[model samples]
Target: MRTIAKLENVSKTYKLADDQQLEVLSQINLDVQEGEFIALLGQSGCGKSTILRIMSGLIKPTSGTAYQYDEKLQGINETISIVFQSFALYPWLTVYENVRIGLIKRQLSSSQEEQEITEAIRLIGLGGHENAYPKELSGGMRQRVGFARALVAKPEILAMDEPFSALDVLTAQNLRAEVIDLWKNKEGTFKSAFMVTHNISEAVSMASKIMILSSHPGRIVHVIENKMPYPRNEKSPAFLALVDEIHGLITTLNLPDTPKEHPISKAIFENAESKAFENIPYVQISRILGFLEVLKDDNGRTKIFELAAKMKEEFGSVISIAKAVEILNFIETPGQDVVLTELGRKFIEAESTNQKLIFRKQLVLMKLFRLIIDKLTTLKTLAEDDLKVEINNRFPYENADKMVDTIVDWGRYGEIFEFNADLKVFTQFEDSV
Candidate 1:
């Protein structure tokens, strides 16, 4: 197979205010080969979409080289087209017009362009929708137009960023099947496809190769090859086993104390104050409590995947909640199973007031919260804007406003501090004061 796109030791960093740099991708290396369907799977904000951008030559890496067809990629690669997660269709334009934009740079004559667009629309099952505006289409149909637009250019690589994520489950399933069928039947049209997804099952169902990334300066930690025959049986032992294995790998990688061998774990544990810089999962306290209650109902032990299914939540949301709980030392995710810690059991068993006390104690133990508490102690109160600025200075890569909001919510819930939303200030709790 020919290598179509490659990233060689690429690392991407964005400069934030006050000379702070936020590293997103670290020493990443990967390739997209002809006839390959590759899935990049990781938690949200792990720079998966950034990788696609690099491959399509939409953006340049801060360091390292991006190549297409063995040549250094400069501007946008003409042979690579992307289907965005949001459908990215113009509301004012009809489906045909939207797809025609893909060929905007190509020097095709009017007749040639029409023939290509028509063929792409037919192939993607959007034949009659060409004249309809985006508002007239269902979510699935909109995504089909996204596919048609991407396929219209006859690109060698079709890159999709969570293509089916916005659709209903049934629609997503049908679209997945159709895409796989198209890939299998229309061999020479597109040599390879690369997808960014959070859904393990989706990756397992489609990709021939799956690359798993670690969050916070995303790095490729594990890669698995799926040799399972097409039309994979989700319930089959082999399929379930692969899913379980990938779940274990992802869970282990996300945990704080899994092992120091990986860069993620090293970056997490190398400093005592590292937690201060870590981006706290922006999950609400109620969700964390709710997840714990669900786990308790399952005898305080269950696989993370099972918990996600039980909650009827996406894997990423469940993992975010788990990470929040884990940061408080209330849970321990060992392999694929999330076991409620002793502290967690106490929190669950405690009354509302006692639960608040426990949560407060945990908050006091974290460096980030402790920093806030110390500042509030000395300063009597902290302005929300000031806190946001401090958080930005500390974790420049994260959304400061969102972090401040989450901090206030968690703090208020734990009685660690009181926030005056009207005044836009955070003050120490009266008892602490």
Candidate 2:
């Protein structure tokens, strides 16, 4: 890999009021290849965006160094552009002028800069609308202008801090596809893209490499390779499997001390403070997924306290046991010994046999919805055997039956993702069918 950027044992510390140095990032090291789409993923305050700033030379590491433009550590280079979460476009300037500003500052000819600005506007699908000011455009359109302005600079690498975080899902998905297309078409000249994102699926689907940073003192914990090809089939077994694997890796890192009342990690088994699934931080998600992993055995049945001891042994905390029970809905009474209930057994079996498959299938279904379709069809004729085969083909599991049961339940809960099931298996709305 051609080293486009690198952070060498980097550390950043800040002096507080009492002159106490607080470390934000420690022993951080990451190297990105030329034209590699890399995502830095972690919880808030994990220094994900900080690393981007460091790489962009917006901030200096207190210790160690970063290298860009193929040399020793240096200050920020001119060949970089950043698109902030907030579209940092100029309020006074029209979209054209806003984009033309960078070229003008570079001392390009008036005609040349205007031509470049025109090209950029067209590329971002905002051609004639260049006369519109920021305030005149909708949020999505304003973002499009920002993207055009960034591209007009013609930098080697682009740094985006949650660029689409504010957009609605439909618009964000379209913009994401457009950005990916932009990168692909301009690969060598553009070099690569580096970004910070809270969305795991966005990271997984887009980046060639995803680096996960740990919290407290932020630092790189794991780096994942997205081996699946571009225009990735999010619904395919391969893509989902990779997503689950990454989820597992993240879960292991944030698995906390075991609980006193339960057999699961507090991070995994949530009562009220669990952040309502989607709002759950990445750190918490990782631990929750890991705890779920321990609830199952080779067969899809619950393993009682055997898995409990194994989990505790690995995590070195009693909270693991408590969380395990909570997640399994396994009751632990003072008079009752540790045993798996019917619900607990089913949960374990479902998790053990079907969690990854379900996750992958759902993601794929989402992808299918994004692609244009002519006619919708119904899956009512998908017999039990056909459903079984579809599950096996798209999301294989050790326990196909258990996986099916879970998938049906997910469908019932509106979590099964009805609108976009799979390109291979599309079903029309009930009335249309």
Clash count per candidate: 0, 25
lDDT of each: 0.86, 0.62
What digit string (tens of lDDT, one per residue) describes model 2 on residues 39-158?
888755667888888888889999988887568667775566778889888998898888776574467777888778888888888877878889998788888887877787888887
Model 2, TM vs. native: 0.60
TM-score of each: 0.90, 0.60
Sequence-dependent TM-score of model 1: 0.90
Residue range with the least summed lDDT across 10 consecutive positions in model 1: 256-265
Superposed Cα deviation of residue 410, candidate 2 (Å): 35
